[model samples]
Target: MEKMTLPDWMKEAPTAVCPASSGKERKGFLDRSLRNFASVLKRAFASGKTKDGPMQNLEPRAKLAGFFLLILAAALFESWIFILALLVMTVCLSAMTKAGAAPLLVRALPAIVFTAVMAAPAVFSFVTPGAPLAGVGGLTITAEGVSTALFFVLRVSAIAALAALLVLTTAEADFFRGLGRLLPGFFSAALFFTFKYCLILVKTAEGAALARKSRTIDSRGVKEAQRWFASRAAFILKKSLNTAEEVSMAMVSRGFEGRVATAPAGPLGFAEYLWLGASSFFFFLSFGF
Candidate 1:
């Protein structure tokens, strides 16, 4: 083998050294928040790709009606036990749909946390007057308040979980088309547009946040961050207006006259009937408390 000479730059030490990074460049709070929010939305919408499941096999209209009944039950029932039972049922259905627990938790966590926070006030004595269950830093948590809070949190959790499961198992197009069939043409069109608009807004916000983060080399002061946020908000608002105008123009070009035509939803079968029966059973059971 022939010996090769090394390049001068490769053999010699560099005159100047590159500066070390001043800690890893972390994403700003808003950037991270937007990224996560966008991720959740994408996952929520894309989740119906699960190959096979009982829920997936059922008609969208049946799933919609059944899930609505369950959510209604959750709202109508005051008993914590009923709510807890509904939550358990939802979990079971989620499992059958192959909607993994981790994804369910990811999808449900924000709503669960928000519900808990909002219900927290109801646990205080000042909010719900009753016998004191416990004392924390001179604040009395009334028993009734505790009960009320628990009930509220559980109900919300059950409802949120059920909603998540419904979305996870049903394809977006089918679900929306079924919804269009169930609702009046004008209302369904509005809902369809609103859903699409929200998704677009989330995607736009995520892209804006990421672009801002990429451009930001140094940490900024609160005022600078606020100004950046305001600018971004205004940009998003303007973008949305433009998007709406474009959508309206496209719709008009397509001969839209305020009504969106949707294909008829599939007829209910045995699986759908069973689902409805189960939903009805639980709904009636909720009444017994």
Candidate 2:
């Protein structure tokens, strides 16, 4: 093989400055947030796939009915103590379940925090005027407001905890199937598919974020970052529309009509009866409290 010499221009070209090494690079805020979100979703998806748990063997219909009744009680009950008790029981049940309490808490924490934040204004005299409990920054904090805010937060927490517990213990298919038995098939099917679609969307968004983060070298300015986020949001919106269309067409091709057919529900067993009784007992007991 003959050796070739470099051109004169190439030889005269200034040596390229070595790109400064950003040693021990830390993950950006957005990247960390994405990772946390993906992990939460993973935990949520994995929740009901377990083969062993306290509630795993119980029928989904039974669980659904019992949870529904308890949630209703939590909502209607006037006593904060009762709601708090319900929340405590839910936490204990979650501990007994294979999915554990940590993941369930993680799933519910955002909603609980949001509820607290939204209800925070209710503690001010302007929102719920009454005898003043304390004064802060020239604003009166009313006793009535405090009670109302406490009640509201507790109710929401109890209800949310119960819902999260149900999701944590039940398989997606079984849960939806049971739901179809309780609610109209059309509605259950809508909810089931919508939930699945949401998961898909989150996964897609996470992947997109990772790809963008991998390609990003220099930090972008605030305006640039905002523009990029807006563009990504629009892209996700468009993709969601296209996906929904494709899904609908595929369903129609597969013989899906407006109504979804569900399997016939079987007779309730001892466990089912027991669950119903316990739920009823708690609900009725609230009357006394």
Question: Best lDDT goes to which candidate?
Answer: 2
Candidate 1 error regions (>4 Å): 1-23, 27-29, 132-134, 197-207, 210-216, 219-223
TM-score of 1: 0.79
Clashes of each: 0, 0
lDDT of 2 by residue, 56-147 (tens): 66788888989999998898788888899999999998888766788678768888999899999999999999999999999999999999
The local distance difference test score of each candidate is 0.80, 0.82
CA RMSD of all predictions: 4.4, 5.5
Runs in model 2 deviating more than 4 A are 1-33, 117-126, 129-133, 137-140, 220-227, 230-234, 241-253, 285-289
Question: Residue-wise lDDT of candidate 1 within 1-289, one digit each (tens)?
Answer: 9899998899886533311233343656785677677876777667547657777878888888888889888888878877888888788877877876666676787899999999998998999999988998988999999988887888889888888787777787767776876788778778777877888888778777767666666667789888988998999899989988998899899898876677756677888899899998888887778
Give me the displacement of residue 252 in model 1, in angstroms. Answer: 3.1
TM-score of 2: 0.75
lDDT of 1 at 148: 86
lDDT agreement of model 2 with the native: 0.82
